[model samples]
Target: MTCLPLLASASGAAIPLALIIPFVLLLMLIAVMPLMVAKVKHWWEHRYPFVAIGLGLLVVVYYLLRIPGGGETIAHTLEEYFSFICLIGALFTVAGGIHIKVKGSATPVGNIVFLAVGAVLANFIGTTGASMVLIRPWLRMNKIRLGAYHVIFFIFIVSNAGGALTPIGDPPLFLGYLRGVPFFWLIEHVFLIWLLVIGLILAVFFAIDFRAFKKTPSAVQSEIGESDTWRFEGGLNLLFLLVIIGAVFLPAKFFLREIVMLAAAAGSYFSTPRAVHAQNEFNFGPIREVAFLFAGIFMTMMPALGYLEQHGQEFGFKKPAQYYFAAGSLSSVLDNAPTYVNFLELAETTVRAEEPAAFAALGDEKHAAVRLLLERRPLLVIAVSLGAVFFGAMTYIGNGPNFMVKSIAESSGVRMPTFFGYILKYSLPFLLPILALVGWLFL
Candidate 1:
């Protein structure tokens, strides 16, 4: 009985418009307001971005604070917040300015290719593995062609969306494999969605490049046979990627060991053979600001996630698609790995009735039961897996590398938005509907 086709398409079954209508309206409101405000106050508009983020964060904090449980509530808050803090701490300790320097004269097209290559490589190696190898070259390209949209755009589409095709592409997906989804199942289902988003990004880029060409903007112009020398020299901060990844997954007994290893990784980055640092020619100060900004975000949103845990089921999701969208929607803002686990935990208890003990024993691992469910009922496990990995692009923080790309993009001069602000500005306007269309047309 879902009145809205798109909602059902997104959720894979009928749901009342009464519930979805406000959310769509809210997305519309959120998507458009920033542009409206920015247009009006051009002077102080940027300041409101942070203030807007703060207000949204306050709502999340209130959710955490309002929980009426005893020590359990406090414990949940501590666990969630500590996880958030530790993830942030891990990134910063790794010296956060992740970038790469490719050989030859860098062009927007060349860089796009580089990102595409990096995306494939991220999955084959770990996402962190590939990001480390390429980020310095990517940053080097930015230094040579500063002020072009190509740099930040690469970070946005590739560093985040690009990685959806593989488990190694993002942490949440890897965790899904741990829970039960086969590694290849990801590529089998998600490939088309990846192509659709990539194609749209390339199309938008062509248009931006075309307009830049028409305007004859000096900054946008690619040089003619210019020096043809790299002048690279940026911090191929690949080690930073490793240190951060290790901190998140390492066992508790190995905490101090991980810290020392990170210190070593950071130390070694300073000694890289290629002088990519010379290309940037700026201090690491800006990337540091990105770190500070995210710390505030992580600290504030922990409790909101806890609150969602306490009450997410009331939304009445019952299909793979519903979990995909809800989990992803939150993953866009929250860390996707944990969000994936949370929804998975919820879905474990989602079945309406136990299977006849014969079949029900299979219910012990619903994620596995989901793939084998077929026409009997929707496969909720597949829904969670598809949503967890695919929807990470819904917002920046869904996966670890997303923030890294944002940090790199800001350092490159894109002047990106705050945590919630990013979702309103980038994800909703551009990424959201694209994903919804994919859900309807393919997923």
Candidate 2:
């Protein structure tokens, strides 16, 4: 089996191990980051948007020499990569300009129930769709529902899990479908994990929400004149998201269409500049952090992927179950689309080997594969899908939507935890255990 370009043409294949070693060096460099991050000069700024961009440039430039397909395909993927961050950042920042932070009044228990139900609703509206629609409302609800952890829970479940079963709901699942995983495969296999995560999170949410609700007495009886304090100042960024969605809906496999759409979006943003004293004032720092780190991961992991494809079978990774857990674990931290691609390559390699016997039977050019255990396909699909959506809740920066919610929360005077702070205080303590349960019970 040969290596295929996800963004480029399939012209280049079979990348050598010798070619991938430099990236291994780069990974080693980052592996000791906990030691390096402290030694930096201006830690905060360098830690954020700049760090992401700098790392991205470093990795891409390093790998550009080794990886083939140096034409429009490489150019296209590069454009798509940076453009995704920029556009998403621009829209996020601009959105902050329009809406004022309004508070809500609800018990933590009720808040948890509301969000648990909200995740289910997100599926029909679309995860990204729901993120756009409900984020502000959730923020408003939290305005009055003071000291509630429901926002994070909302991000973990409604913002992420709610989209696990459908490609339309999450970008990663869409990538899987594009790579030949069936659209309905997620629902058939992955929904159980989604439900488990949701159920557990909701249960936790109920405990915390209820506890908080009890501590804070209702202000309903007081002379609070302004009941509807939540105001909605419409921003043009929402319209831009709709356009991006429209552009994405087209089978514009490459960045040509996305580029054109992005160009139009850029034009619209420049033309309709928001007031200086915008609501939250969107920052690129967070998205910058994600872009740079993932770019390094994306480029360097190309080699790791090459090795996996050729040798996954040697390591007794022949079943769909193995692929499921493997892809899921990587997708938990690594960006999900590329993780899906890596596994797809492995699947192709394994299937191609059976071609001789299969060819002897059906004699098809695109050789058929013997299905693994009946549980293999479903289990694999579910693991990847569930991990992509659910584990994102494990960290604030794990998913795009998670940061968006955090930023919105912080702007509204809610002191959301810092990076490691968030993990130690919230994610590592609470979420990991449930995630482990899901891994055991399902994956």
Candidate 3:
């Protein structure tokens, strides 16, 4: 169960608050059931469909009967759902084929270095790509002394915050790029906030890791034993990785992007020897789980997004701080890619109403959007960008890498935090304070 921002309704239409109860209940179930019901500890993997599918059917029926564009919405949603699952599955499949073998005990400093390097790599390779490449070695090295906080902090930095500086780094930034925003515009605007968030989070992680490192038993440390050189295998998969990147920039209408990515995934599977997959311990289970759960998410979110698109400005969310929290809060649970586009649309529409000619200039020129954004409503763009990326660290579902990283860690024998445990224990206490600081400083 999960909640996303629901619109008030279209054009003064009075859709009842109860119209969104199913979505809220689903989000709540996803958040609370694991912690409350032992049977649901793996609900996302095994049992989510009961709730997801049932509620999804209800949503489909309601829209078909009551809404004007309901059928079209459903078709579009199915398209998006397939696209989302395909891209995520392809990335997971390709990344899993490339294995990094390490021969060393994971010291506190060494672990920090790995995460730091991953944080930087996320920009060029994407959060999903970087996480897949580095997560196994990170887990194996720290296996003897691993703690839940290690995974938590890794998600906060490497899986989420590290991707802030480049459009290729995160999905929301990529959307901005596809729009008129320049490739380096994000770096120019959001670099300082990214550095501050990463720096503060790293400091907190080092302190926690130092304590955990000291508490590790000598017997366990002895199991890690010796150090040797590192080896990388299945280098051919790197070519497939490039294929996935190239496909992202392709037009979505012809289904070329999906076809290319799916083919690359298949190519990686056939070309990569079974031994490499064994080394990575790769399987389709996690991606399948994400695909199923997100199918429900996309189905249910259609109306809610429709409402937001139509009625968002009516809610009087004119301030940058308002967009920051509103967008970020939803991005915490919803897919940040669409959430980013939604808020971007809202921001652009609001700005255009005030200065139509200036905003129109943004369309014809390359960096005009960035320039107009920086000059007129810089905070709005920054808020939307930062909120989408940073708040994604709040939940396992917030960003693509968040779930992938969790699944990888669990496969490596690390006990990751539950969904609610993540929000209540880690994000609320740690990330929220930092977010508040970011708002106070920048927004």
Q: Which candidate comes out best when scored by lDDT?
A: 3
Off by over 4 Å in 2: 1-44, 47-103, 113-140, 143-145, 168-171, 177-196, 218-226, 235-240, 253-256, 267-277, 283-296, 319-325, 331-338, 353-378, 400-429, 436-443
The top-ranked prediction according to TM-score is 3
How accurate locally is residue 379 in candidate 2, as Cα lDDT from 0 to 100? 52
lDDT of 3 by residue, 1-443 (tens): 01122121323444444666666677666545544556557654467877787887888898778776566657766765666566667777887788887776587777777788888988866787678777778777776777788888888888888998877788778756655566677898888888899888888788888887778877766766375558899899889988987887687777888899899999998999899899877888767666766677666666556555455567777889888998899889876776786787677656656677996766645435345656789789999999999999999888877877887788778887778888899999889899879988888
Residues 1-443 of candidate 1 have per-residue lDDT tens digits of: 01011111222322222332322333333333434555554543345336434544553444345433323433433443344334333333333244343454455466557666766665544554454446555655545444435544555565566667665566556555444456577687667667777777666665665555456556545552253444323244455555555544454353453464446455644564433334333243433433334333433433333333344457676666777787777666555665665666456435423344434555444344334332244346556655666566665546555656666667756666666666676567766776677666653
TM-score to true structure, per model: 0.57, 0.71, 0.80
Computed on alpha carbons, the lDDT of every model, listed in order, comes to 0.50, 0.56, 0.75
| Overall local distance difference test of candidate 3 | 0.75
Scored by lDDT, model 1 comes in at 0.50
Model 2 lDDT tens row, 246-340:
55445535555457555655654465445422334544455455566656555555555556555656665665556665765655554555666
Identify the superior model by TM-score, candidate 2 or candidate 3: 3
Error of 2 at 126 (Å): 7.9
Candidates 1 and 3 compared: the better one by TM-score is 3
C-alpha root-mean-square deviation, each candidate: 9.5, 5.5, 5.0
* Model 1 ranges off by over 4 Å: 1-100, 103-108, 125-136, 142-152, 217-225, 228-315, 351-359, 363-382, 394-396, 412-414, 417-425
